[model samples]
Target: MNRLAALLLDRRLVAPDLLATGPIPDLRGPVPASWQGLSRTVSVSEGLIALEADLLELGCALSAPLRRRLAELDAWELTIAGRHIVGAMRSKVGGHVDHVPLFRGFPESVPEDAFDFYVRRVFTVLLQEPEQPCVLCGKVATVHPVSPCAHLVCRACWDGSDFSACPICHRRIDPDDPFLLVSAPDAEDDTARDLVPHPRLRLLSLCEDPWAAAEKCVRELLSGQAALRPEDLESVAAFVDTCAPRSARWLPDVIPSREGKATALAALLARAPETLPDLLDRHVDTATDVLRLLNAAMDGDAGLRRARPIAARCPAGSAGRCWTA
Candidate 1:
């Protein structure tokens, strides 16, 4: 057994019956006339395994083990050769190049972002419940086929927006194709019954409650469990504004009195220190005091320290004078 075949068999990525026998076909020649109408070939090489594939040519380097394995299989004809050759070859031989594994075992030849979109938005649709609600607006959806791709979007969401393409996959919609609607009544029923709020709606609710939202944001930032989404930052800012209203203007004095408030302030400073002076000037009577407190809080934290320089750029009237302290 060649090293490549042994590795693939050990990893369970390829079954023994799928192994090709004899010599690896040289694919460096002109395309065959019979294979002219099929998809273009993509080549991938990893260690001792090399594969070249188009619709007609699915060629792989055969190791001794692979050849022996093929010889032993009574069902060899019913394996990868008899199935979808291109896809099977891609799944089997496309792993690493120059010792670096491709994204999630996909070939480096595949466009990462496009393949990700295809897998996540297109392929995963098959696993989705027939009555899955619209991801946006939490509405019961009548699934309409978005064109130029196989992505489905809710009719209400599609009609509500002026989008010429799918919102999720960003694929162009075909106006010529009839809108095929698959009713998702269960999703609507769930929403109508209020059994559970949609994730987007839950986020909206959090944004509406500034204090609670700010606390949640601070906890997320401190834990380092997951990075905050762009929308989370907006919610955090809204919460900060609510707690330290621009007119009230006494942030440093009030924030230190509560642990949660202090942590939230520190998290905000850590996240966008460039906005520090502006935030303090807008919300604090004593911006210098706030700057000092923030600097002290962020003293040993690497992530927060990276933003210290930007915070130091605060204007003279705000934190510039106290920055040196």
Candidate 2:
């Protein structure tokens, strides 16, 4: 079954009546054709994502202003997606378009010469030790390293090639590498299917209003660890964004990282700014954590940039620079 694209709405824009009331009408939009059941998952921060990995297929999905690739869009498309998010934060629909591809899950294109790509895979298989049985023939054979990439080629199965690039990496290797050959034919149909599976599709929630998203992250993010490991930043931000302010009591007693504590409190306080004093008194532990909250508030004053809480990047220890950067 095809999955409809999910929209993650900031709770502030959601009227209290709408949230308190029955099931609301979902904001509808056209989805990308590539977003089939199979696609990479995605993520986003309240802010601060490095453009490339923050948006690339292998990069971090969580970040703000702009995130990574889940679709076939370029930087302009990414910026447009970010602009829509920016507008949603400001509650402005004056000039914004309703439907745009915001997905970071784009399909990839492989080499056209199917057989050449398949046969080239032998170099990848040869990465195993030459002393072991030959990967191609399943028996011990004389294996020699190709010139530049140095991928071992099984002499028993095939001699060499005349291709310009390294078969495994598809990069330009030594032109004279004995493995490069023009005559290498492609694999048969059965073998082709086995090799064609693309990267597993990852589900990245983009402003989807699901309480489950927050609950799923609580066990993993709000751990007793002192400082957030570099990788935890994305998970932490996602948790804070998805969490509801009323559920603040559900927060862990001790949120370890200064960054984590501030993020949680800021996201909570954004919608319920009246509780600012109490949240500050209770959750705001250190001076740095206070600065983190202050930094978010400063950027998003008067609901102008309300998505600031999750946008706050920089790890805990980078105290002085955290506010400025």
The lDDT values for all models are 0.34, 0.38
Summarize candidate 2's per-residue lDDT along 177-267 as a digit string, tens digits. Answer: 5653323224553222222111221112333334554454554576658565544554544555445554465567666666666656556
For candidate 2, what is the TM-score?
0.32
Candidate 2 clashes: the total is: 35
TM-scores, one per candidate: 0.27, 0.32
Q: Which stretches of candidate 2 lie over 4 Å from their true place?
A: 1-186, 190-213, 229-231, 299-325
Candidate maximizing TM-score: 2
Worst 10-residue stretch by lDDT in candidate 1? Answer: 197-206
lDDT per residue for candidate 1 within 202-298, as digits (tens), equals 1000012323433444444333435444444333334443444331222333332222333345444544444455545434455444544455344
Local error of candidate 2 at 311, Å?
11
